[model samples]
Target: MNQDPLQNLRLSHPAHFLALGFGSGLSPVAPGTMGTLVTLPLVWLLAFSGQTGYLLVTLLACVAGVWICGRTARDMGVHDHGAIVWDEVAGMLLTMIAVPVNWLTLLVGFLLFRMLDIFKPWPISYLDKHVHGGAGIMADDILAGVVACGLLHLLIFIGWLPVPAL
Candidate 1:
């Protein structure tokens, strides 16, 4: 009889809890997507603090994620395991920075971030390949968020997407 490998991971551990995206990363499906989806409410709430606060929170998450993800990965004996997704949470927050928190923006930002993260084009791919540890796990998703944020802003600037009055 085969036991589930993840059963050994204790969600009670703070690093494991966070790195697993509050358990959303344990989903049998696309855990990364689930992790990103679970972060939408956080993004919306942070939007109330305005861009500066949002950026600050995102920065903090990114910084802490290095340890959170790294610790969990070490425990799991896998680098950047599919079950660790704090990076996705941080990436989604970064993607939503300065953007109005509405269903549309949320959807677009989620899709864009996921796309960049999944595709890992150019520098993102390069960093993911060369980097290691918690920072290595986060580098690709962070870059994806940055690119998606830029694309999202461009969409609004070009009038392809409207900036709803806040």
Candidate 2:
């Protein structure tokens, strides 16, 4: 019997690619970390589209991703497993909003978002543990995005970051 822990997210499935974070979730080790890294390039490219486009795309992805992730997880028979990383993709996209399309800001946002995501501070942690189904899978990342947005603003306010040119 084949005993791979997370097989439902097949690369052949388009939903899997979107939900598993463009195949980053397929990494044998540290899939969550890999998912975040995989998103950096996409995020960087999207950042060039300006704040409006960035926000719209991220919002759309998040709204659609919940279902894709939920159904894919159910198909794979795993519940919010690390390999299902659409939430990370959507959250990372959200973090790019209103931030400069530069390496420094990307690095900062990536580090901060990943930290909040993994640590699941306060209400974020609460949501992750309590919510069920796709909402549960997506909620924690949404909170992380909120925290990242706040931090990005703070960094800009302190002159540590530059406002993106629309």
Candidate 3:
């Protein structure tokens, strides 16, 4: 079985490329955070088109990520390998759905999403443990994104994080 996933970086398979976050997942440390950071600029650009467009793109990315992550994980003979970070990218996108395109909001969203993803609170933890396959790998982070989204919105609602006027 293929255990060394680093070999995927050399192969030009689209799924591998995407699942690896276009090489951001190669980081020796905190690859998930790196993948999420890599998503910031893309999310910023997507935000230019407004929330509906961003939501549409994020939904599409999540759908595509299921296949990409699953194939990459299968090739590596593992489930949710550390290097498969397309889930992070998709999750970050989902997290920013309600956030305004401000650096502070982005940073806060990043931190919150990372925390929720790592800590795996409540149902997020439950799903992370119980879910299987690509969907399983993606579900926890997606829910993390949801939690982060709620927190960011709550902060905004309470005047803790200012929402820049669009």
Off by over 4 Å in 1: 1-5
Predicted model with the maximum lDDT = 1
lDDT of 2 by residue, 57-85 (tens): 88888898889888888887878878898
Count backbone clashes in candidate 1: 0
Rank order (by TM-score, best first): 1, 3, 2
Q: Higher-TM-score candidate among 2 and 3?
A: 3
lDDT of 3 by residue, 44-128 (tens): 9998998788989999989888888888888887899998899999989988996777899999999999999988899999999
Model 1 C-alpha lDDT per residue in residues 66-155, reported as the tens digit of each score: 999988888877889899999999999989888877899999999999999998999999989999999999999999999999999999
Write down the lDDT of every candidate, Cα atoms only. Answer: 0.92, 0.84, 0.89
- The lDDT ranking, best first, is 1, 3, 2
Superposing all C-alpha atoms, what RMSD in Å does each candidate have to the true structure?
1.6, 2.0, 1.7
Question: Which has the higher TM-score value, candidate number 1 or candidate number 2?
Answer: 1
Instruction: Kindly indicate the candidate among 2 and 3 with the higher lDDT.
Output: 3
| Pick by lDDT: 1 or 2, better one | 1
Write the number of the candidate with greater TM-score, choosing between 1 and 3. 1
Clash pairs detected, candidate 3: none
lDDT of 1: 0.92
RMSD of 3: 1.7
Candidate 1, clashing residue pairs? none
